[model samples]
Target chain A: METLFYDYVVPCVCAFLACVGFTLMFNIHGMGKLIAGVGGALSWLVYLLAGSTIFAAFLAAVAIGVFAEIMSRVRLCPVTGYVLVALLPLVPGGGIYYAMRHCVAGETQRFLSTLLHTFGMAAALAVGAMLASSVFRAMFPRLRRTGKG
Target chain B: MDYDKLLNMAAELGYQLMYSGAEIYRVEESARRLLYAYGLENPEVFAIPNCVIVSVDTPEGHPITRMRRVPPHGTDIELLERCNGLCRRLCAAPPPIEEAQALIAALPEDEPRYSPRGVLLGYGVAPAFFAPLFGGGLADLVSAFLCGSAVGVCLLYGGRFIGANGFFRTAVSSALASLLAMALVAVGVGESVDVVTISTLMVLVPGVALTNAMREIMAGDTFSGLSRTADAILVASAIALGAAAGQALGGFF
Candidate 1:
């Protein structure tokens, strides 16, 4: 129970707060900010529930992308705002930090391995987000009609 | 309708979209739609990262082209959404050229949506919460909050002077934040300096660039996608380099 509280509940709350911060920093306004925060919280919740792995990060990113799309449609805002803020918690900052630390300490092998891992993680996130957005685009043909007149 | 004014307005719209960090295809699509709604036959719109080019054939069988060099600004989602809504409204109604011009000129200037104090609070709170997500403990959370506030101060103030040079601003702020985190750990304030540093820097990472780059590639804009990918890599490397420099300096002190 303690583990669940620490691992899932705490992070979810933090993620929600962090997402709100990002919404403010990114200059998102109105109720869209709250929806963006929910998008971030949802992503973090999925990430924690899916366990710790590269695949988990990918799935979480996909969840974020899809949620952002829904929010964009509902709120009439750009997806760029919500999607970017929501994915902030999953960015490979820790991996990049460790990679740089290894390089500074002259641990070439460790640096290389860490850098590769970071690259893979970033790639997974990118692919997942791309897939989700692409699916959204395909599903909503009317949304693409920017030339109504 | 004067073709010159119409072309100018369309190009200006594209510039606004690009400046707000909209995707390249989106910019091009918006420009093309605006021109088409304004009675331009077969308007050709091409938007790169830094420039937008639009061309349309006149009644005299001559092609008139207008280009605008849009200076990139920080992502302002409010402005992007407003401009997008304007485009959609224009498309649906095909407003007169004069009305369209007024609408474009009336677009809101970029402004911070929150007060300075609120922004600072957000900066501190975000990293404080992110610390635990990245495996930091209670002590690390407090340390990260402090370090993140320092970064927030640097961004709020240093940005006024160094806002023009994005690379230098990012590097300097990131290095200073990492240095503060390291000092806190050295003073027995945090359990792991690495976790604190990582969590604090999360706000500055290039997650949006990476995701946009992939989406651009999937949308068949390969050149833009590749360039965006390179940009993301460069920014990531800059943050890493700054953190390493900070660690070296901290070790010396």
Candidate 2:
């Protein structure tokens, strides 16, 4: 567990940066930084736990969307602000880099697969937010009552 | 209802708002109040710095709203400072909504509501890079990298308007920024830029935001939170493209 934490440190920090950056970008108010940081970490955890990287990516995105809504309600911070941070853990920077590297190396098959993987990950993350929100509504009767409550 | 509080909120989030953009001022004020009242934070706006400012009167049988001119470009450091001052005042004596509405209605017709187009977009992108800093692992890094690429694709066309350059130029610029970022990472200097700063900087590229924005726009509202989301996606895509270009260059050696 200790080793896992140490290994995960880099991604968590990146997630934190993503969250803070989102808050700064959108000018979210009151606890924006904190919300983003926690949200990013949570998203990263989702990614880590899921069996497949793609599934994990999707779960993280959805988690962020739902969590953002929850933060907006519970913390009185901006949902978009939280979403921005939460989604940070899924940006796909390394995948793109890998794909490009392969492409330059004349490894066309590897490059294409990586490219597909990169975009697929993004799509999953983007749609995941909407799906998570729906699932939350289904599970929590109280949430549906307030219409974003 | 507390304009100063709203302004402070905007400032804290790094929104470059103009004092003269009263319509946006009103919208932002309303958003601030409503978000608090409804218990929602960072609710996306339909349009920023609304082009029109309206004053509704119910003196007759039916209430009607009248909008007047609120000029743009009056936003200055002075106004930002005033907002800071006002935030302090509001903290001391928060006003009622009715009073707040009246105050909003009383603002000079010449005041325009102006907001920097992508300020929120920029702020939104930080988490992708920052997650790793907080103990997120290779999974998180993978997420950031992929998300960055999608962001690059989104920015291919949308950035020209923001940068006032052509789409190709914007696309190339996005590629360039990512290239620079990759170089930083490859030479063992990625530590200096750090994951958070890189994500924050890339978030402004409109990569992820663009996808959300298009979806929202298609649903109905032109300037909704979703649209801002699309802008975010494109920005991210641009950054990723640049990074990919740089990585490819590095792999050559």
lDDT per residue for candidate 2 within B112-142, as digits (tens), equals 3223434333333443455354333454454
| Model 1 lDDT at residue A73 | 73
Local distance difference test values of all predictions, in order: 0.84, 0.49
Task: Find the 10 residues in a row with the least total lDDT in model 1 chain A.
Answer: A140-149
Q: Which ten-residue region of model 2 chain B has the weakest summed lDDT? A: B13-22
Docking class of 2: acceptable
Rate residue B22 of model 2 by lDDT: 20
Expressed as tens digits, the lDDT of each residue in A1-149 for candidate 1 is 99988778888888888888777677788887788788888888888778867898899989987888887777666778888888888889888889998998899999999999999889988888879888877887435554431
Q: lDDT at A8 for candidate 2?
A: 67
Q: What would the DockQ be for model 1?
A: 0.69
